[model samples]
Target: MDRIKFGTDGWRAVIAKDYTIDAVAKVAYATALWLTRKFKNPAAVIGYDCRFGGEMFMEAVAKILASKGIRVYIPEQFVTTPMVSLAVKKLKANCGIMISACNGPVNFNGYKLKGDHGGPMFEKDVKDIENLISEENEIDLELLNWNYMLEQGLIQYINLETIYMKEVRDNLSPEKFKASGLRIAFDAMFGSGQNLIKKLFPDEVSMHCVVNPSFHGVPPDPVRKNLNELSEWITHTRDIALGIALDGDADCVTLFDEKGNLIDANMILLLLIHYLAGYRQEEGKVVAGFSSTGKVRKICDHYAVPLIQSKIGFKEISRIMTEETVLVAGEESGGIALGDHLPERDGFWAGLMVALAIVDTGKSLKQLLKEVYSITGPFAFERVDLELNRIIRTRVIENCRNEVYQNFGSFKVIRTESLDGCKFYFSENQWLLIRPSGTEPLIRLYAEAETSDITLAIIEAARKTLVGEA
Candidate 1:
């Protein structure tokens, strides 16, 4: 009877409260029904991260699927999101499910659904599942069985880690990487990326990989604030050419240069665009979310590639990717969907691509970034999350809908975009976006400028406006 609503990625809630066994059962039942109706006795590949109780949740869902005469393939051990995706594609399963909160706090957990193509389901597919949830019959608790399902061959255990490692080996060019002799350090942050560096590189790279479920009490977001140890280690070691950080589910990535500087997602986006457009000489369009930096536009313009800007979610980018030959589709957040791969965001793939780019160019990651800056000029970006009561948050955003900004210090609003939220574009390629966070009771302000000071000032002014102080 609990209200189970899916958010930006999937349905995530505090484990015992909203994500109770009953609620998870309901989701599993709904998914089974949806899959049965859509495919011929559909089978699913289920995976889980190293989060607490992840395996239990996976087993619970698998039992639910098996009870409904649906085949279920559960991983033998903890696996990353990309592994589930790969299994979905390799086994030709009807759907893929991963049990993880995906960079959220330790107290939370979630479920993600991947389509047949091994990518996040399209928005309409999620909507269809939601619709089915309302009409489906509640699952019978008496039908769930741990041993009977295994005996009946309804639930099969698979080796997703081996499958994923083989895929990485086939796709990644180790010879090119060894040519550079670049020593890379990876901080898995106690998420699913723990074994990836060792599996992919073997003895070729150095790494600091740990699978601590606590993640030192901080949410497993790969941002500068949470990656202090990685930064300090990279700085002091000096042998690491790059430090890669992956979130809890290993579906998003952030990088640190050899100098221990956290390279923002915008910089990564630009780097991918430059490599794909210039080096690979791939002629295709680029898609990015509105909160992304304008440096993407500069790179696209320089390469004469078409660029499409969409709303804040990677799902929107994924939608565009299906219709066009998108070279790269990414958001301001760490989610990246590369060309020819599944349209879903995979941090493991992103990290591998970063390594490949460095190898192909025969340059250090920092040197490659320097080249990108020379082409697009320098850009600084930042975002601030302002927590508020839900009612107050809604009212503040509604009130700002038609509000006009005459001036903010020396800046003037030149244009406004209300596609996802209220984005006020100012002169000099600087802008501020005010949008309500879908996953939390907060308003997020994203701003970018040519200098850090200007970016911070814009964020401050936007905060004042949100609080009615300006």
Candidate 2:
């Protein structure tokens, strides 16, 4: 087998391929060894999502950890990524494991590790676990009898969804949500978010809340292209005032306005910051991924809140959220974590907060966004993913590094920044970022300008300049 490696957040591979039983066992054994060293009496909260073989993989992880003499707590049913993270803190476990790939394609499955503080494992801890993967053979892969192990008090199954539901109830204002009288359409994308969101808001309309491992053949990501079903449903339904969709593991979300217009994460992040800082009077540092809109800086500056930019991924932003007083931490993607909540991303929390923000202000999403743009000003953003041949991708990166291109069509390269990716600045607010995907053979081009048309134009120009037209 190839060397087991982890990506930005976790280790994911095509199911029945690199993500086979032996692969999971390797990860589990490495985790067990790492946890044993970290805790005197190590325990873990293990859970799985709606992916194929979730339960079987969860059992495999449990068996491996139990064989190592570490106790395990698992959910009675499939749970979201945030639920597992919350369980780690609530159960006081040394760490947490999730059998999910977040929003990866249907054929993919993954493993995500969580720290004791209820967030993604610290970067150092993740490295330690990765190092241990190479020495997985050091762990004794003994198969402890399942029932016998349970009798010995090594495996415990608890209603993790109940605890997570209670946590959600305690954190969000249900009364405000009910009082708003606004119709909401939720699409779970056939992932783990199905049950809880339906139970949490039974009065609301929802879709794709069933156990479909295939995710209806569409990728389980909550992005615009993947969320066509929800968008169409909401747009056709006149009474639905909002549309919310969750990714596979339910840690991230995408929202749509009353008219079914896709509200990107940048606007959502800006709106959340505005609500917390302007309306709720909250204060602290704001941590955002490098791909987030520059408008975040404007919003933070407007509120006198310091803004810190990290490399893309919730793990990077979440690491800082755990150490500092973070008012809000989010990525350009839909993953966002609020202050006074678990440092980990919570789709339910983010959706509820957005709902509550609308209720508190007694305004529509468009109005709330207008309020945000009043401060941050209007900015348009777009991300273009290019799936090119390896040679072409490498050459593009080489050109970007060497500064071979002085202009992109009409947009000149006025400045260049390489904080995380190669960023070519056209003006102060207009820029383009070319970043390669860490886990996949794709180059992502991000463009931000004054309008959506300009953003798309810039991206297209960069694409032509880099890889040329097909």
RMSD for each of the candidates: 2.1, 1.8
Give residue 197's lDDT in candidate 1 (0 to 100).
79
lDDT of each: 0.82, 0.87
lDDT by residue (tens digit), candidate 1, 157-200? 98988887777767776566766778777888888878887776
TM-score of 1: 0.95
TM-score to native of every candidate shown: 0.95, 0.96
In model 2, which range of ten residues has the least summed lDDT? 134-143
The TM-score of predicted model 2 comes to 0.96
lDDT of 2 by residue, 62-134 (tens): 9989988899998888999999998899989989999999888899999999999999888889989998885
Once superposed on the true structure, which residue ranges of model 2 sit more than 4 Å away at CA?
135-142
Please, what's the RMSD in Å of model 2? Answer: 1.8
lDDT of 2 at 359: 85
